[model samples]
Target: MYINSSETAIIALLEKIKSLEEPDSAGIFYNAFIVILDAFVQPFSITILVSLVVLLVLLFFSAMVSGSEIGFFSLGPQHLEKLKQSTSGRGKLILKLLERPKRLLATILIANNFVNVAIVILSTFIASQWFNLSSFPVLAFIVQVVVITALILLLGEILPKMYASVYPVRFSKSMAGVLNVLIKMFYPLSSILVRSTSFLDNRVARKSHVLSRSELSD
Candidate 1:
């Protein structure tokens, strides 16, 4: 019953992921992942309908996150060079964000993943029941995976990324404030992710994944 609720499902997944690093936990975690998806059908109810709406809203935000990263970070050497010459506040803010590439990367990663996971969980509840695909487990899983993948890639990733690439400055400016707020709001999760990745990268490469200022400028 709890698994049918979107909020519960997201929390469950987050809790599950937190254990992924533990020894011999992969099988347990994977089993829980498959077991979380269950029916969430109702004859008619405003409350139930609202949950589905929330998922759609999350999908939209996920798309924005995908696009914002491209728009914000796709600035080239020449673009950064020109921005450095400008004295505008927005340019200064952009430069400031670029200066902390790890935080920027971590913030986008956190927001994107958080939204995307919620979308998947919500979709699992609605898709299986709405389409009556529960009768065929293999087919249902395939269909759900395919549909979600297509929607996320087309609407949430490809379209937005293309638009961001085309109008980087406009999109980046529009997204800057929202991203700044998200970075702070999700800082706890972002910070942990950044730190863990840095630790692993240093072990593997003898350096962190974080880019240097000169590297960013180049």
Candidate 2:
């Protein structure tokens, strides 16, 4: 009876091992684990998270810079004097920077363009990293444009400008140093843009200044 009972226990252990090694049983267990992991784990990695945060920060600053243009230029003579008298270093700095309109315009334009380019590149990287965007070629391009454009248009351009218009003096004062540094950084490019715009303006003025032939209309 003891020998018979020992044999029965050994047979049960062998049967358990065979069941575990069966193809259908192993496949079911493997697939179930995969499903559980998929359900619980988020796909984003640290680098992806960092990139998104940086992208948002860049967009916010870009919008502010774009709005500063309107805010700085729109100040009337009376408001300008008030800013000049104010003790805030930023207010004084704003007046000084505004003295050279061409330089200011060029700097703002260059900086804004740089920020926008960065936004586009970063956005593309995110889309590729997160969504494997290249797989859907047309959709990738469209998604990139629509997402970036909406952010830039709504946050970077329209809202900032509207806010600046409402508080031009305050906005200019706050952004004075930032604009100054950006201007200095891109001075060469800013000067070139100023020269080109001046040339274009003079050319148009000369054409418009020319008189029609007396024989025809004069």
Candidate 3:
């Protein structure tokens, strides 16, 4: 009746270990993997449910941000001309963002990283709750590194970008509203990154030009 937080946690871990010990519809390795994946399959409480939901939403946003990079950048000169002539507010916003391409790219990179980090954090929390992942270092590493990396690569990066590339304007227009908000929110950081990269690029260009001139002299 007087179970403290530690005791509760211990009890939960014990239950998870007990579940792992039970026979399932699969073999040892598969069952172990399933045990680690229990967070997705079993939602025993509202907190886990909410975490799962938020994790999914973050993943979706990650996909959107990743896709937006391809969507906006792949726009051709003709597409940009169309954007300039278009009366739609979203098209106007897209043109505005493209005016400062470095800043816009920085904003998308920052937002994508933020969303992906959140997804990893929320996923870790959910996994920890469902299983004593710490007890299995290798399994934990697999789940955390390999599995999550694959998910982010496939779901957050590749698939969305593929779609975006095929329908660049539509994807960019769809993401215009979200991108506008993110550009403002991340303006400070994005600007700093833009300035730093610009400075580095100029330095590199100068160095390359000097090397070329020296080669000509020789």
Best by lDDT: 3
Candidate 3 global lDDT:
0.84
* 1-218 per-residue lDDT for model 2 (tens digits): 45443344345545545566555766656655554334333388998999999999999999889999999999999898898778988888988998898899889989999999999999888877776443346777777889778888999999999999999998887789899898889988998999999999999877766643443565
Worst 10 residues of 3 by lDDT: 34-43
TM-scores for every candidate against the unseen true structure: 0.66, 0.76, 0.79
Candidate 3 clashes between residue pairs 3 or more apart in a chain or in different chains: none
Tens digit of per-residue lDDT, candidate 3, span 16-128 = 55677565545545644554455333447788889889988888999999999999999999999999899999999899888889988999999999988888888888877
**Candidate numbers, best TM-score first, in rank order:** 3, 2, 1
Model 1 Cα lDDT, one tens digit per residue, 132-181:
45446787878678888788888889999999999887777777788889
Candidate 1 least-lDDT 10 residues: 35-44
Instruction: Please report, as a residue range, the 10-residue window in candidate 2 with the lowest summed lDDT.
Output: 1-10
Each model's Cα RMSD: 16.3, 12.6, 6.4
